[model samples]
Target chain A: MNKLAAKYLRPELVPTKACQGCAIGAIENWLLQAIDEMELKQEDVIFGAGIGCVGRQTFATWGGDNFGATHGRALAVATGLKVARPDKKILLVVGDGDAASIGASHLIHAARRNVGVTVICEDNMGYESTGGQFSPTTPAGYVTNSSPYGMAEQSFDPCDVVIAAGATFVAETTAVQWRQTVKVVKLAMQNDGFSFVHIRFPCVQNFGASALGSRDPLVSMEWIYDHTKGKTDDGAETDFAWETGIKHDASNSRPEYSKVLRDLNARVRADMAAGS
Target chain B: MALSEELVAPWAEWQESYQDGQRLLEAGTYALTEGAVAAGLGVFAGYPITPATDIAEYMSKRLPQIDGYYLQAEDELAGMHMCAGASLGGQKAMTATSGPGYTLMHDAYGWAIVNEIPVVVVDAMRVGPVSGITGAPGQGEFYVSRYCSHGGNIETIVLSPNSVQETFWLTIDAFNLAERFRTVVTILTDQVVADMFEDLFLPGDYGALSDIVVPRRHNLTMPFFPADSSEIDLPPNVIGEGTGVCVSPYTHTEEGYDIEEMEAQWSQTFRLINKIRHHKDEILRYEAVGLDDAEVIAVAYGATARTVKTAVLEARRQGVKAGFLRLISLWPFPDELFERDQPYLVCELNYDGQLVREVMRAAPDKNRVHFMGKSGEMHTVAEVCEALEGVAKHQKMPQQPYIWTEVR
Candidate 1:
């Protein structure tokens, strides 16, 4: 076993169901690495997963508490968990279909409310788990099982949506850029208010073979990085248009939902005592 | 840690501050919301739907005062999911909605049931196949609450309240049952019961709050469900409680991990049903008036029961042998209460009969079961009396099957 795997991964739960060359495995390992680097206890963190290929990452051998939410509703579940246990850090992991399609409303509203939770969207372009159907994030003219004649609508940019919806921190990276993905994920965990990290990855078995005209997954991943506009090296000013680094970072003075609730209760108690 | 004394002390004080001579008059929605607070509700999330909106509005203003959390979710689907999430985090959470919103919540309701997460859902019935009427009273959701979502071999606890006072007490009972069984408890009320104003007796004395029982975590070896019905009373380990537990909606083994084998699935399904089914005697509740010696009996619940009571009295005055059976617990279908010899006239405020179907199934003779119902309108006492008169005159009212069509 590798050194990191020996320390962090559950030995009995290895050999996952993810397809060969799928980025989900690598992305999950990177997240665990980040968690370990931060020295956060497993008991202090909870993972909420939406349904999809990426959602299966909730079973990562790290042995932390995991909640499997319904399709496109992980953010709502995370919001509730954050309110119930504000001391615990909440992280939601979802795919494109779970985030941009059925769960779009939850994503926007959670950002608008500025709830203290981090959301990680692993975009594989289409719905790979349901056999490669067209999704909201499938690029226009991309061929899929549902859209044999190519997608008719434009793909949605979730980072822009969350930033516009008042997310305190927003970042976009890809599985190929492992270091950058780790850095941003760590940053999101450290941030206070609502944080979003959109990671564009490749589905080896489905999207790679169907849309990219290639059976090899690495080829499809390289095509994605070459086409998207982002910095390939370190020490560059991150642009807002599909930039690999932090897209929007602002100091939010607005109170988080849980903190506001706590303060309000304290104030109300004080008022009652004074009146008495 | 237990809930801080300061957090719950004000609510206790508020309950005690009611004057001894003053009678509190409030809507049924207010009573239901206050009852949730009294039950130690830690989180309340919901969307605004007709007749049910008052419950959410009242909770929005009151939950914060008690150091509890309230969220106006994007929709009923999200609201139910939030309630499940909060419940899994060791909080007693609840949500309220009407028919349309209740339909949207079916998926999450199933999630809570399968995972054994305790949450309360209050469905204030309004008319519907599709947004039928905002103010119309209907019991169309009676069966839907019992067999909701798309699955087989599923069971849940459902309660019905006919008046504002009952609405308050039943809400508390719903929470208690939810905690005890580790299942989702639904409080089924209708538009008439939710909106009607009445004199509510506010109790100056408060009972000790029921303790929130969280399951002990066995580290990585924690099993969410017990091996057999013998251990069914144990609560499942919650997330973020140092359990390192994984909760899934798919058929799972005792360790809370997903399993695909049929034996694993059957074991879990059987336990889910038997947990509530075996305890039917403890869960069943109803009120019987004069059924002992009567030749004819009327079965009713929710708002329609009020009319049934008066109609039964009128039938007796006119020398008709009629009695009333008012149901409090709708699900687990109190089948034992159905007498074999007496004929039954089931009344509800829906186009097609919902509860009458259950009555017929439980009855020894389906031929003796009759239904009187109307859409978007309550059955008048006179209408019920006329039905009782027909039974007295040896007339037969055939059973009506539930059908879907536009409500006119």
Candidate 2:
């Protein structure tokens, strides 16, 4: 708050509606920093805020004017915004319950539409806001408000989903890796057509510790993702090729997309697939 | 000058609007095309549908002369998306359809709203309740227009043009209003307007559509974003590389990231709405024909409005002080117009009272607003005249439900 720190200080109030302590919050801080550092144009960008938490974030507190929409429907909404106002930079934010679940249809289709929009999904491995519940990203053995006796399902890998969905660009990172998350977020913005960035946000309080309050617990994500991230597919470090990728391929027509998804699902059952 | 029935073109010997609908059919299609052209509407991406199919036909045949783009989409969904995309590309764009196609466009409409992307949708209403009357003029989906897009946010600007001329006028206004407010707009007509023909002075260069301010697109570095602005409510959004960041559905902070920012953002969007609503004088547009000093006021919009106008004229000839208020702006519902000094008749062609409901919400005096409406079929001047006569004589009106939207 002091003038002395003001010169070096960066703005902290993010323009989105992410929940408190939600990994999505830092996106503003980092993105602002990137913009300031990169010196990009403010008029050139447009935003497409998808449904669920992202909807509230857009149509409200974002750069230029932003569009927001219903749950699991943000991608399609973004696709529309991008199409309607192609001159503006388009960026979409979504969540596991939103992107991996209800919005899957729109997510794949938007990428297929490919008019270019930045898409970032917050994967806490569970639906935390709708009450710590099971999500498409929930680990097979994880428990939630909905999944009582431990989830009998494995989480989806969104990166492979992007590549197969015909996304021009795709990457996966974690909120804890603030720098990397910021990098990908910025990069996704720069990518033409549909760009996907999956944030492996650890729901430390909800899914991991169930500590309604707070704790320092983190995902042993390093165990699942090879040090090489999701790209080194020589099995060099990532023995499970299916685990470390965007889960669905929307780019492939109808049949090929179905087959690739089916194969990806098989690996997920064995924990051999990537968690992001 | 008061428009005379004799002036109603096509010289149809038949006296009723329902019977002499030949003019209505051609008028609806021509007006839609002319409206688009007026708004600097340079693009029309659409898929053909019955009753609404002529919108595409007219555009395809006429847009080239105006240097407009008329491309048929793979389907209704894609057609709507193309409309949205073209708008973003800095072109006023539109599309037309009925129930089935309208359903497909729901997704596109939602996107247009959240992004404050203004678009005009011409939904020539057909039957519904699961595609009830596709080609027949059924006002079934009147209420559905509110829900056509996403985001529970309401107060969208939808107009109903009863006559062909009004259709042309409202179509141009759709683009103007959309660009002005940065929201989706609708010209909700029915088979009556869609399938009608009328002689209207098509405003040259989009019918005198000029001097309207369209928002300049702001990218990341527009300086408007993060506008070193000291104003409260919301910071200016800069749209460059990093500042453009990511905007998602998750509640995010003011910097364009999906963070825990719901409460903060909710206030901001409401502020946006407040900013627009406060300027009621600029947005409040409507017409009061034959109501200089009337005992009864028939308030309606779209094609229904045309009937109310006709009916009011018929009543006046019979010495009844009947008048009509053709509501131009449906959302930001013209409360001032209804609350003003006159008895009212709310008429529409829908099952439930949607437009009339808004009138009631505005002027809650209750007794003054005579809700005369119908839905199953379009209203004729003769029918409106009868409704006006019953309401004018202050007779205990029969409880017979209107076949169109016959409810209290």
Candidate 3:
């Protein structure tokens, strides 16, 4: 599924160090294309990569200026980098565990200030990062190394969280859809305020069918493609669809979105009960 | 030439200035605040605390006048994080706090260093590990301010400004150096100087304040990182994506993904350290007063250096030929300094006698540094003079020809 991206030699920029099906490969492509299409320069950017597999690799292969900070602290570092250099383009890339778990304070306030930094939570569910331990995004009723009896806590919904945090622009997409993902990321870059994009990526080594028996994200995202009502100014009421992401306004109002997460969890539980 | 802001801002400038540590710290705050703002630090996120609170007042009142943002954050930790976030967005950012507020930011500081975020922190050192003695001024947190936030072999550049002039200029320089080296630069002065009154010379032009070179907004030529090691010829950054970059605390591949190879570890560490090490000429600064033909050199910093200067002169008058080395850039250890010259004794007011040990480690021939410091009491000029005279009396080295007899 090598989709033709607009206007550039993206392969030279794409690091070959990543494995065959690493989720970030396509993500890297989308990000570069978005930067090129949107005419971005490095001086305008300072990315904070949280500690984890992705954070470490992003620092090694990413040729841009960035601060590869502590584990579970992408947003915390991003907060400092942004405040110190408010005129530069700022981004934070974190694992679901990094964002929703330890660095939660920075994540919430970064969104709360609408502090004008972009966050890309590469969600694979669970800390597939650290040998498949349960994370803030580990699905309930699913089994992981740390959740052998099934994940006790519910999963976190990033799209809803961002919308609630008063993020000016937020979207959910995956690495497979190169053009669309690039579109969302580029659009976020162009935004004058804070932007959040959570990618529903799957870790081939960890959270795949063998690990959780969950459907492939490529197939799962299919439901979103058909169910998602396109953005409309008339404020159309859309139903709560797990595949389609959040339907609420993308402004400062996270509490309402909390219900959406709760609803998503209940729906998943009901389905699990029926299957049993 | 012109009435320097460092001069006028201090109070009234003269041939030379001094503080015996019983400071009017109020004037020092004005110097630091105005110096930073004038250096293009227009954003401040802080929680109010004694000694450091006046800085917030000035930022709140002065920043709005110049289109700046002064946010009283939810708490000290959040405020510090806000300052961190704002800096990444390309604002020369700063925050001021005393011990309790500073302690809350320990882990966050490590994150900033790991991420390579350039920020200026003003710590008005007070007594205590945790609110031990918030009130009565004590230079206890000197070591905490210097070494607490180390994620690895990362360095924290600390500047101690003794007088109001140095306070203003040091803050201005802290902003410049932090932006230049891309790390946290601290103005580690005590509450005495923190609350003192003095004249300051506000620089006419923030002297290259707005000229901070951030990561260049060049198009992602390949990705942020190259796929192979050979392709890592990272060019000079030229940024245009004012809102395109994302900052994190993790070590992602150049594409901003995670890595675990020996290669990633070496590369990131190399890059992080090189940012400061490569800029050694610009990053490391110090003042050597009367070190040329001296029997003994007193190495000092911040408020203590002001006291040391007076003692150096008194020892010279007593024909002991004592000298002084004032460390403006405390971190990076200033190893090159001790290499060319020796006869050093580090003086500070701390219980653990921390920085002096660092000074000794940096020097080739380690000497037992006689300390003239106490936790609560100030490091006075008379005490330092007493120590220097004692060193001279005990030294086996020959004395200089033209003798400066003791006046009293």
Candidate 4:
């Protein structure tokens, strides 16, 4: 086992049940690297996840106290946990389906409230665990098990949603951008308000076979790389491009959701004491 | 207006101990808020809905006064989930909503139940399939509260309070039960009970009543869920305490890790179901009047029970052997309460019967069980007396205006 995995993850669940060449495991390693760099102890962080490929693969991998909420409600749970344990850090690792689809309302509201938590949306583009169903984040014109013809709907950036909802920090990275992903995650955790890190990863078995017509790990990764750069190996323009890196950074500019409540309580108690 | 009555509940002791406390006339919502505060509530997350909006308003103003957190979530789904999260993080938490908002909370309800996170939920029921009559009372959630969450192999602790004073103590009992059972306890009140103004006595010192209020305890050892065992008062697992507890929405091992074996499923189900089933004696609470010599009984719960009790006394005044049985605890069916071989007339606030089905299933004779359901209003004392007298004389409910008697 890698040193960080041994230090931060459960031993029995180390080799996650993720499919071979899935980016979920690799992204988790990057997250651990960020946490290790910050020197945060296992107990200082409360890991939470939602239901999907990211949720299944990453759930309970953390050595600290963790919870896997019902689909799309991780932020809601994290909101409560933050208020109760304001001194501790909360890290929510969920999928696109959980963060942007089923749990979209919570996501927007958590950002609006500026809840103190770091959300690592491990986006695999499609619902790979449920057999490559087309998700809201799946690029237009892409084919999946659910959308055999094409992904007819236009995909919106979750980054834009959170930024509009008043997130303190927002960043987007890909699976292959190891250094940038780790640094961005570290910065996200440092923010004392809602911070979202969207990392688009590749799914080799289902997404590759259904959309890119290849199950080869290299082929799937090269496709993501091409999309990241908007060019194929032969220098031809790809169908779409993902503008990655730090999109917004307003860390601690406003009061965090839990601290707002704490401040209110303090003021109320002070008034009561003076009156008495 | 005297009747032979037997009260079986924890409050029977509380009323005596707090006899010297200050008395006041207040709404039921105020009593619920004060009850939760006295019970050491640390967090309240709620979404405002009719018949229950006052609770959220009261909590918002009162929680900060006592240094508790009040979160007005975006919706009931987020509200209940936030309560579950707060409870898991080693604080007593609660949420309040009516039928419309309560239906949105089933997902979080099941999540809290399976994970054994202690939380108190208040569903002030109004007339509804979906937001029917917002200001009127209804007993439509009787079966809904029993089967609160979607799957089988689970049991819920549900309590109903008829008056503002009972609502105060029952709210405290709900929190205590939630702590002892390590599960969600639903206070299945209705609009009338939630909004009614009545006499309420609040204890002078919450600090002095610490013995009755179950303080939150953290489990730091392994076997976070003592699966396969029917134990009570196990300390709930706490997050952010370095316990490495894993709480999720799947069948789990005793250490709280997700497991996928038949044995694991059965063991977890056994713990969830039998913990309350085996300890029903501790959870059973009811009020009975003149059952020893009565041939017919008028049964009800929540607001309707208030009027039914009056109707029973009036029936005795007219020389009829009518009794009153009011259920305070609605779940675990209280099968022992129906062991008597007498006719029962179930009165409720919904045209379609809910509690009557349970009465039919638990009583000796399903044919002898009659339903008097009224929607959008309470059962008048006269209506209840008429049903009781008709059942006593003719073994059937007589035709009446706006009273439903069919339960098929």
Candidate 5:
């Protein structure tokens, strides 16, 4: 195993259950690299995972304290963990279905509360773990098991949703752009309040064949890069690119949920002491 | 100070916040909410549901006063998930909801059961097949509390409170039981009990709350919900406590790793079920009134039990031999408490008899069992007396059939 992988992952649970050439593996690698770059202790981080292909990576690889939350409840779980232990860093890892579909309310409210937690949503277009069902993020006219004829609804842009919901920092990246993914994750971790990173990638085993018209994982990666907008390391804008940069970065003036709670508690204690 | 004193000093400070003296007449829901605070509730997450909304509203105002956390989740599903998360974080966590919202919480409740995370879910039931009546009372969720969430053979610790005072004490008991069993403990109250106003006595002297045993970091490396029966009593380790324990909703092995083999599944499922079932004697609790020499016994629970008690007294005044058995612990179904030879009239607020079904199964004579139930309305004292009179006269009224109607 590589040094970065060995440092961030549990040794016995290495070589994840993710499918061959699946972006989830690459995304996990980038996340570990980001943690390594930040020099954060694995034990100090609490990882919350929702139910999906991306959620499976939490226990399968991440060496932190793992909370396998119910479908679409990873952020809510992370919120609780963050509040309970404000000194620790909480990271929520969920799939597109978890963040934008059933658990969409959690994502919006977590951002609205400005809780101190980082959310990383692995957007593979559809629910890949459940046999290629159409997710809320599956684009219009995309065909999958559930949307055989093609999805009628327009796809959701989670980055824009989180930004509107009052996230302190929001960004978009892809699995193929490992360095950019790491950079975005590092930025999110450094942010004071709710941070959201929407990582769009293809499900090589499921959605790749049906929706993206590609069976090869490399072809899927190429399709993701070619179809979306991206920015080079030097920060030059390009059309139809992967759009790999921070979309929103709010000032740290807004109080976090835990800090506000602590302040209120301190005030209450003071009132009690004054005996008024 | 010693090491143990250092560990307990924070709890001591929290206990000092407990107020003494009567807080005045309030709704049963207030008792529950205040009782949760008195029980050292560290976190409360809930969504707005009629009859149960006051519990959340009260917590929102009170929890922050003591540095406790209160979050109004987007919905009941998220609320329940938050409660599970908070509980797993070494806090006594709870959530409140009515029937419709309770239905949305089945998935998370099941997750808590499988992961063995302790949480208290307060269900103030209204009439329901789905949003049947928001204003009316019903004991319709009795079965749902026990058998909720899809899949096979799951048992839970369910406590039903029949009075405003019982609501307070039972809320504390609910948390205690949840902590003890390392499972979900549900406090099932109805709209009548939850919304009814009464003078609740706050104890003059408050004692230190019962300590919830959080597993030490050294012991957390083992399976959270150990498959071995002897080691099943250990509480789950809190996350971010330097206990890198992995908790999953799937059937998992001793090390908290997901496993799909039949033996592993059987061991895990068996442990989850038997952990509560084998301890039924400790879990099952009920109050029997005048069952000793009575010819007829009326079995009831929650708000309906209060009316049943009144009717029993009225029946005795009329020279009828009717007694009441008020069920406090609805699940683990107190089968041994039932007298097989005596005829029973199971009364509830729901049209379809949910609790009576359990009565029939537990009683030796199923033929002698009778059900008097109505939906979207509480049972009148006169109606219960009439049922007792009819049962005493040996004239069995036909079982009330469930009537389903759409309400806009």
Candidate 6:
């Protein structure tokens, strides 16, 4: 294990169950870099995860207090946990299916309430854990196992959705952009209200095989790099490009959801004392 | 009519310990809310639904006053998950909803149970397979509460409150059990009990009743799960306590990490099932009247118990030996109560006959157990009395309007 990972991750669970050549572990290392840069202890942060590849691989690897919530409900749990322990940083690592599909409502509502938590939505574009089914974040015209012909539906950006729902901080990065990913993650953790960091990574085993027509890690990495730069290796324009970087930066602009409750409690208790 | 009553519950002693309380008239929802507050509830997450909506309203106003949180979730699924999350973060959390919302909570409910997160869920049932009569009462979730989450290798604690006063004490009891068992405790109340105004006694100072309320304790050491043991009162694992505890929906190890091994599965299931199974006596609570010489007994729970108790008294007035058995604790089904070799008329608020099936499985003779199912409304005292009289005189229940007795 690397130095930063050894500092924050469980030694026994260091080699995550993520597939060989998959970027889940790499993205997790970037997250650890951010946490280490902030000088946060394992105890100072609580890791929450949703069900899917991202959730399973990253769940208990955080050698800290952590929870693997039911599919798509990690944000709901984070909202409650934030209310109970607002002093601690609650970070949720979830998949595209968890954040944008099954758990979309919770993601939207948590952002709307500006709950004090940082969400790392690790989008692999497909349900790679369940054998590469098409997800809501799967790019249009992409061929997943579930969408042999093509993903008929247009893909929606979770970053856009969270921004629309009033997320305090929103950022998007890809697997190849490790420096930007770590920097933005650090900024996301600093936000007192809801912070959503969308990191799209490659699934070499399934998504690479079906979408990129090869299971080679190099092929998938190069494809993601091309999409990030919006150009191919030969300088031709790519079909789609992810407009990466910090999309929104209204950090700590409003009181957090739990703070609102606490303030109400203070006011109500004051009135109760006055009435007595 | 005078009836010999035997009330069996821990709160009977709890009531004696805290006698210096104020008596006031309130709705069951108010008692439930105050009961949760008195039990050191730190968070209540819920969605507004009929009959149970008043609980959300009461929680919203009451929680803020006492340094507790009331989160109005986007839906019932989110509400229950939030409660589970709060409980994981070392708070005594609760959520209230009706049938439709309760069904939506199954996913999070399973997660909480498997992880042994302490939470209380109030399913104030309105009639439904899917949002039936919203304002009417029904005991439709009798079996659903036991198999609340999918999977058979688990046990649940479910209680039913017949009146407003009981709802208060029972809510506290539910919280205590949730802490002791380190699992979800469901209060399967109904519309009538949740909405009706009745006399409720609330202790003057909740802080003074520390002996009665189970305080939330955190497990800060290793072996977060202890899946091999059936022991009670092991402090629940908290997320922000730096315990490094791992909680998930999968079968887990003593250290709380998920494992797919069959040995791990067996050990976890043993702890989940046997914890309550071996300590059934601690979880059992019921009220019985005149079972010694009674020829037939009227069995019921929740709102249906209200009229059934009256009917049993009226049966005695009509020169028939009829007994009354009102179940307060519904799950870890008190099969011991049905040991008496006599006819049991299982009265419930659903025509689909849920409790009757359990009564059949428990009673000494399956043939002796009869169903008296009614839906959308409470059974009138007259109807229950007639059913008791008919069962006493004849071998079966007499044909009655809107009452379905066919259990097959």
Q: Name the top lDDT candidate.
A: 4
Predicted candidate 1 versus true structure: per-residue lDDT over A59-127, tens digit per residue: 535567887787888888888888888888888888998888899999999988888888888898899
Which regions of candidate 1 fall more than 4 Å away from where they truly are? A3-9, A228-242, A251-253, B1-22, B207-221, B230-232, B397-408
Separate DockQ for every predicted complex:
0.64, 0.12, 0.19, 0.93, 0.60, 0.90
| Segments in model 5 whose C-alpha atoms lie over 4 Å from true places | A228-240, B1-23, B208-219, B230-232, B398-408
Candidates 5 and 6, the one with greater lDDT? 6
- Candidate 2 interface RMSD value: 13.6
Per model, kept true contacts as a fraction are 0.71, 0.19, 0.42, 0.92, 0.64, 0.93
Look at candidate 6 and give me any clashing residue pairs.
none
Model 2 agreement with the true structure over A1-276: per-residue lDDT tens digits: 332113222234333345544555555456555545555544565545544443453344443444455556555434434433445665566777767787676577666546466777767667766667887777666567787777887776766665776776677766556677666666666655577878766565565555223434423334224432643435454433323333333322232221232344454444433553
In model 6, how large is the Cα lDDT of residue B300?
Answer: 95
Query: Candidate 5, TM-score vs. the true structure?
Result: 0.91
Candidate 5, residues B216-295, lDDT tens digits: the string is 12235666557746334576667876666787777777767777898888888788888887888767667776776677
Which has the higher DockQ value, candidate number 1 or candidate number 5? 1
- List lDDT for all candidates, in order: 0.79, 0.59, 0.62, 0.93, 0.79, 0.92
Ranking of all candidate structures by their DockQ, best first: 4, 6, 1, 5, 3, 2
TM-score for the B chain of model 6: 0.98
Give the per-residue Cα lDDT of candidate 1 at A88: 89
Error of 5 at B246 (Å): 0.7
DockQ of 6: 0.90
Give TM-scores of chain A for all candidates. 0.90, 0.69, 0.72, 0.98, 0.93, 0.98
Q: After superposition, how far is residue B199 of candidate 1 from its true place, in Å?
A: 1.9
Worst 10 residues of 5 chain A by lDDT: A231-240
Clashing pairs in 1: none
